[model samples]
Target: MPRSHVALACLVAIFWGLNFLAIHASLEQFPPLFLVALRFTLMALPALLFVPRPQVPLRWLVGYGLGFGTLQFLGLYSGMAAGFPTGLASLVLQASAPFTVLLGAVLLRERLTARRALGIGVAVAGLVLVGISRGGAGAWWPFWLVVLGAFGWAIGNISSRLAAPPRPLELTMWMAIVPPIPMLALSLLLEGPRRITDSLADSLTAQAVPAWIGLAYTIVFGTIVGSGIWVWLMTKHPAGVVAPFSMLVPVVGITAAWLVLGESPHLLEIIGGALVVGGVLWSGRLVAARGAADPAGPVDVGDPGASAHAVEPAAR
Candidate 1:
């Protein structure tokens, strides 16, 4: 990869990694779902207005958007709201990488390799370790919701691969537009208009600065810049190089949570986070090194056995 592209990739990683903190900060007052809906609503602005719509099948577009944008966020935010800690959520969501690998096997008829399976095992073990340690910290069920959200994101990954939108940034932009409606509907159904209205009202009156900062960080830094840079990076390099950086999110997540919220990880959680990051790194290096060795091989991404290609084009 060119130095500029590498720099861009690193920047995207930083933005995304910092996003865990952004989510934590935002969830302070905003109901997770409502906050998420507000996030997408804010994100859709310039994209809906300025970005050209991509030409793709409507179902693919809708499915990709809702699966990734709505369902994934719903599960993640709800999980966090229910009790899953920020650092833990960061670790569990990496399951989406392995989930995408499995999804590719089933949906795209992609082959699974032993090494990738091993990486998955390591990552899962790490998650289990973290979960066990955190058992007393919160409800287990919500953490499962985050896992489900990872699965939903994995589904979106397969859908994106199948769709292969001609214009990835445009696709991302349009896809981003899909979340606000469903999230709004969910918020209305679950929280009721009264609660949401009260939250918003409170924000306007006294001040919900954390919510504002969270919303701004997610909308501006997380979605727009992060997704845009990711799409651009994929255009310049192979997916394998891009996917591994995702593991770093938890590093930033844990550190930021500790700094901002005084949320500390237990020894087990720390050890688990290390294993998860190592697994992801091992998976990434495996593919990248393999691709370098094979003269005729095209680089791949998403597969621990291979590389991560599922969201290669959307790593941001």
Candidate 2:
């Protein structure tokens, strides 16, 4: 990969890392489902008008939306609201890599490499440590909910691969159309209409300024600009080259949360995070390093066993 594309990948990682902080801040003002509803609503509008619909079947599009947009955010936002720390939530979400590997092996009939299997084991151990460290800190259910969200993300990855849309970004944008209404209905049923109204009302108040800023960051930087750059980078370089950069997301997420939100992880949590990061790197290092050495080799985007690191936006 060129130095410039590497820099752009790092930038996207930063935006995704900062996304956790924004979610944490925004959750203070909006209920999880309601906030997600608003997010997709913002994502779908205006841009949806300008961007042509992706040339894919409706089933794949809807599957991508439900898995990625609806289920993933629904679980993640709720988990954050349920007191999953910003930094840890970011690290835990890296579970998606392992989850994606396992799912692809089973559903997509992709072979599970020894490295990937080992990576999954190491990451699962790290996740166990994370659960142990955080078990007493807060409600355990939320942590599991976030894991569920990670699984949702893995499901979305499979959907994306299956859809194989010509334009990944447009698929992402068009898929944005699926979540808001369903999420809004969920918010009404669970959070109640009165609470939703009150939250919207709170958005107009001075105290909600941070929430609004967070929303803007998520909509503008996180979704539009960040994803656009990601798509461009994916086109420019092999997915193997671009995907490893996502590993930096947790580093950025942890650091930004500590600096901005004053949320620091416990020593054990840090150790566990290290294990998780190490596992992912170990899994991808072989393929990515090979790709780096032979830049002209054809890249395999479909083989999750070999190209797990090449997938775009594992935690997005």
Candidate 3:
């Protein structure tokens, strides 16, 4: 990789790493689904104007949008709000990588490399360790739920790859259009009219500055800037090269949570997190090297939506 591309890729990692803090902050103020809806609403408005719709068939485009946009985030936000720790959420969500490989093997009839198979094994083992260490707690289910969110993202990744929209950024923007309504509907259905009304009333009554600011950051930084840069990078580079850096998010997420939110992981969680990330990184590097050597090989690197299968609809 060129030095400039390397630098840009690292910057993209930072943007995504910091996004956990953004999500944690936003969740503090707004209910998960409602806040997520508000987020997409903010994301879609201006983007709808500047980002042209892709020339792809409407079915594929819409499928890409709904899968990646609506289902993925819905599962993610719900998991986080339900008490999935930010750091673990970041780590476990990486389940999407293996999920994507599996999906590709099944759906696209893609062959799996040995390294990918080994990587998946190591990652699953690490996840088991992490789960065992963290359980017997208040919110363990959300952690698993977020893992589901990662799966959802993997599914979305496959959809995007199969769909092959004309313009990735435009496709990303169009995907943004699908999430808000479904999220809002879910919010209303589950959170209910009274609770939603009450939460809004409380926010308005208190004039919660943090809530508003957090919302802005999620929309501007997490959604537009973070995801937009990610989509741009995916267009430029191989997905495998780009995707491994997502492991760095937990490093950032945990540290930020410790400093900002005063949340710290146990020693076991820390060690497990290290194993999970390092193993994935090693596997991803192997995958990249293989791709570079084989020009005719099917490319499945750096998909941002790689975790779609793990992400459940409610969890996002």
Candidate 4:
């Protein structure tokens, strides 16, 4: 990657990190499921109109949508609404990285070396500490929901690997078309027509301006610009060179939440988040080193989400 691309990678990380604050803003005015529906609906329009459909099988695209777009955001938005902290949401969502490693080994039949195993174990331990910290407050369920979202993200990553679309960015866009209908149905079923109407009605008010802006930010920067640039960089550089920059996201997330949303994390959460980032970076580093040692190394796709975030450490 060129120095300019490196800066772009960091820019993507900042956009994604601040995306947590945007989600929180939207959730203040929109139902979580409904937000999921609307977010994707806004994104899906481009897919329907402008973006070419990825050449992968239909099932893979749908699976990518369901797992990455639908399930991941469903759990994520729901958890945030249930009072999961925003900074931590960014941290916990990273569980997808380790989950990807595990799923790749079991479902994809990829080899999991001892170093990878150690990394996963360390990451999981960090997660467990974070979970325990919340459990001490008897509000652990929301934490699990975010973790489930992370798992959903991992599933989406697997689907992306299987899809192996020639245009990964198009795959990202087309998958957006999957979430709106299902999530909207859920919103109608769970959030009710009255609430949906109320939320929409509320959107016109001056108080709702920030929420609308946040929504636009998420759709434009978070997905289109952020993920688009990520996939572009992935296509251009080795995954190892690209993957480490992703670690910056939580740093920005936590810092932004603290500064903007006034979210001060628990000591345990800080420690745990450190472990999670460090462990994931460690695992990614080992994978890159191994690949560097052997340029003929087989490709192993890894990721946070096909939407993640994009290019996995093992993709090289």
Better of 1 and 4 by TM-score: 4
Best-fitting candidate, measured by lDDT? 4
Candidate 3 regions off by >4 Å? 1-6, 204-207, 235-241, 288-316
TM-score of 4: 0.86
Q: Is candidate 3 or candidate 4 better by lDDT?
A: 4
Model 4 misplaced stretches (Cα beyond 4 Å): 1-11, 229-247, 290-316
lDDT for model 4 comes to 0.79
| Residue 313 lDDT (model 1) | 38
Task: Give the candidate number with the greatest TM-score.
Answer: 2
Cα lDDT of model 2 by residue, 137-185, tens digit: 7668889888888777767666666556667788778878999999999
Per-residue lDDT of 62-111 in model 1, one digit per residue for the tens? Answer: 87777778888899999988878786787788777677667666654455
lDDT of each residue in 1-316, candidate 3, tens digit only: 3445556666766766677777877677788889878887877887788777776556656665676667667778889888778866777777766776677667645545677667667867777778887675656777777777777777666666554554666767777787888889999999988877777777764556677777777666665666566655544544445555666767777777788878888777887887777777777776556556655332553333333223322222
Instruction: State the lDDT at 75 in candidate 2.
Output: 84
Q: What ranges in model 1 sit over 4 Å off? A: 1-9, 136-138, 231-242, 292-316
lDDT (CA) per prediction = 0.71, 0.76, 0.68, 0.79
Q: Can you give the TM-score per candidate against the true fold?
A: 0.85, 0.87, 0.83, 0.86
Clashes of 2: 0
Indicate the worst ten consecutive residues by lDDT in candidate 3: 307-316
What ranking of all candidate models by lDDT puts the best one first? Answer: 4, 2, 1, 3
